[model samples]
Target: MSAVLAQAPAAEAVEDLAASLQEAGTVAAPPEDADAAIEEIGLREKESDQVIDKSDKKDPLYAISITSFEDPALELGELILKGLYEMKFSRPSKIQAASLPKIKMGRNLLAQAHNGTGKTCCFVLGMLRIVTPDTTPQALCICPTRELAKQIEEEVLKMGKYLILHKGIKVKCILRDERWERGERITEQIVIGTPGKIVSLLNMKVLDGGSIRMFVLDEADEMLNLGGLGDQSKRIRQRLRKDVQTLFFSATYTDAVKRLATQLSMDNPWSQIEVKREHIFNDQVAQYFYRTNGVTEKLERLTEILSVVNVGQCIIFVHLRDTVEQLANTLTANGHPVSPLHGRMEAGARDKVLVDFRNGTTRFLVTTNVLSRGIDVPAVTLVINYDMPVRKGGTADPDTYLHRVGRTGRFGRKGSALNMIHDEKEMVVLKQIEAYFDRQGLIKEIPPDTDGEEFEKILNVQ
Candidate 1:
């Protein structure tokens, strides 16, 4: 390690870098236009034409499949193979085919794959194989949100059920519901949770890292960004052993995330698998936009769109907690069954709201960027960005916009994303998002409130 890094932890290193730059007055101002903003930040658009499709043999990655379930590469036992059969996962998806081998070899991974592509299964299998009964937390899987943490925990339990029942192994969810006694050890061989809870356990000595050998970060792009969860995750990793194997999985990437990956996986124990932006966003969803005057007109346009669009299950993403509640209440008063979700909601209430949305009891969910990544609601058909995301200093949030739209069009199903632009400023942000998606007419500009036959003919609105 460098002397500076050794003296200061990763979190402090970031702060120190910022402080030093600010002190020198070298922090450049951001570009006014979103396209220029992306370039100013050193992020260039991905050049490609083909889109992502797991079932398409024409997909270049389709050639990369595993031949033998009995291969020693994965070293799957008979019981695990039988369990896989029971789950009806006849073949590994694109990401799984490419990632499983590298993971089993213990190489650190930086993978970018959309949801419903079986990426979780790849890490789950690796965790199952790596975990041993040394009576300590041997594996740690950290996610961005409690909802995603629970989702991953559910998959881990399902895939590793045989081990859980036969070998007396355990997979624990480290959310608020899990209670711990003072001075007690977390003996689970595999652990999964959000960042703060995991860090708190380490601090309290309740979850020792001495036995942790494998660290998996789901939605790693989000976890490694400049945010609270990212900070906590870095501190948590700093506490682990040097040789610990790390795996990063996400649906997208930016220059910052790529730089972080190279820095963390610097020992040459690393492998990267990234798809072109076009290849990831094409064909799955039809993107469209409608311009509004501002927030006042936005409410009217949103109501018009909702009344027109045939929403099977929809998620409308905004940029604030107050907006979520406001929109949810407004739509509810108009007789729509909508639920609001944000970071501040209580744990039980959050779980209940998500459950209701997932089970189709509530057909609409209004939320913040909190629901942007690692959220898999396969039934959703419509995603409306009520407000495009911007960085703290008003730079474009293209990565987040991609995640917001990815909520739909899962598993090769055709879905749709509608971006709401208020003015020239937001139009700039939308352009950056468009360029990130390869700008070849993927997103269409639909006039606001075009109704009746025109709505059906153009947008297939309900």
Candidate 2:
């Protein structure tokens, strides 16, 4: 996780940050509508639609190298800058620097950046900037899962805390099993949820789509490709106002995905800032892979690593729900406390597991891809891919692997990624991923001959 979205700053840190900003004289006086923070938004967009809808041909890598919070390109207001200062955001991330200018211009953006690169904050800032704090749904964000939706909702609330305290600003998250029934009003300034739930709400007329000024698709590739979410997402977006700014963000972008996203942008043409796949892996994570004989050998190797390595916290990723059950049961029976999360589990059960993991009460979490992309847990010093991510056709899944390894390296802290590979076939896939990332030199092989001293040094925190 990146420092930008890993966790909320401590209360004392927040105060210290505020003091530092005040001393620097960058903090502005409270707005005249201090009670509301922001006035009600007008019905139409304030920017010219035609100019923003054009595609951007700038170098994607160069586009994201911005380091200033008050970059003139973003065109953020003084009050928004003040709120950002209070959040202790010392600088804009590379992705933020690249996309904020397009965002401020009201462009229909399709951006590709690695996980934890402040993608969530980039869109949250855009949403907060456009929202008028009125009772209508000015902005809507769609995620692939409930946990991710909640994560986005949490960040939005934290970023907008000042507005809540001063102007009574409201943002709502529609999670699993929650519904906005017909005849009931949805009067939040911002709404976030899974695509299905949002579409259902729209069909029931619970949400006034015409009033939504911004539409954002987080994890755009997954929301548009997996399951039947593409149709549902399209339905939800089709209902929004014509000139609404449409945005997409994901870690990977295929040619098909780019074309689909462009088509989805509809009346507004599309633009993108794409980082090469080989360059997305976080340098903070020290990656390693161990070769084994088979499934039994892989588990044995994992158990050995767990027993030998000193980790602040750990997560083990499997590919199937049943594997999660078997591995969790086996580990617990072996006297290692752990938790399991998967798609089939009830929402309440998943929530409890995540809460425990995030609080550091549960040090180890075993799961499928459910927690791969967006959920952030504290103190995760190790991430083990017990079973490598691959598609049903046995093809490499670089995107899934990237997100899984991203679970560690929290808040710019150094961490370890251990890939457990069994057999030549799996080894080939591992090499493919290594080649895909151009990380042959960065990722090392963990030979069995290594003494405990060498292994311990590998896991040692800097």
What is the C-alpha local distance difference test score of each model? Answer: 0.72, 0.73
lDDT for each residue of candidate 1 in 1-462, tens digit (9 for 90 to 100): 112111112444334433432333211222234334322222212334222322234322222334334454456675566655455455455566566655655567787765555567778887887776567788899998999988888778877878777777789889966777769889888999999888888988899986787789988988898878778888888888776788888877778887886677646356677666656663557888888888888788778667766767889999889989989999889877689999999999999999998888888999998888867776788888988888887768877877788787764455788888888988888887767677656679987657645644565423
Q: What's the residue-level lDDT of 325 in candidate 2?
A: 93
TM-score of each: 0.83, 0.84
Which regions of candidate 2 are displaced past 4 Å? 1-54, 57-67, 71-75, 451-453
**Candidate 2 RMSD to the real structure:** 10.3
lDDT of 2 at 104: 59
Over 100-190, each residue of candidate 2 has an lDDT whose tens digit, in order, gives: 7557556688987776666787899998877765688888999888999998998888887776666666899998677455799799889
Q: State how far residue 216 of model 2 sits from its true place (Å).
A: 0.7
* Model 1 error, position 310 (Å): 2.3
Clashing pairs in 2: 35-167, 36-167
lDDT of 2 at 314: 91
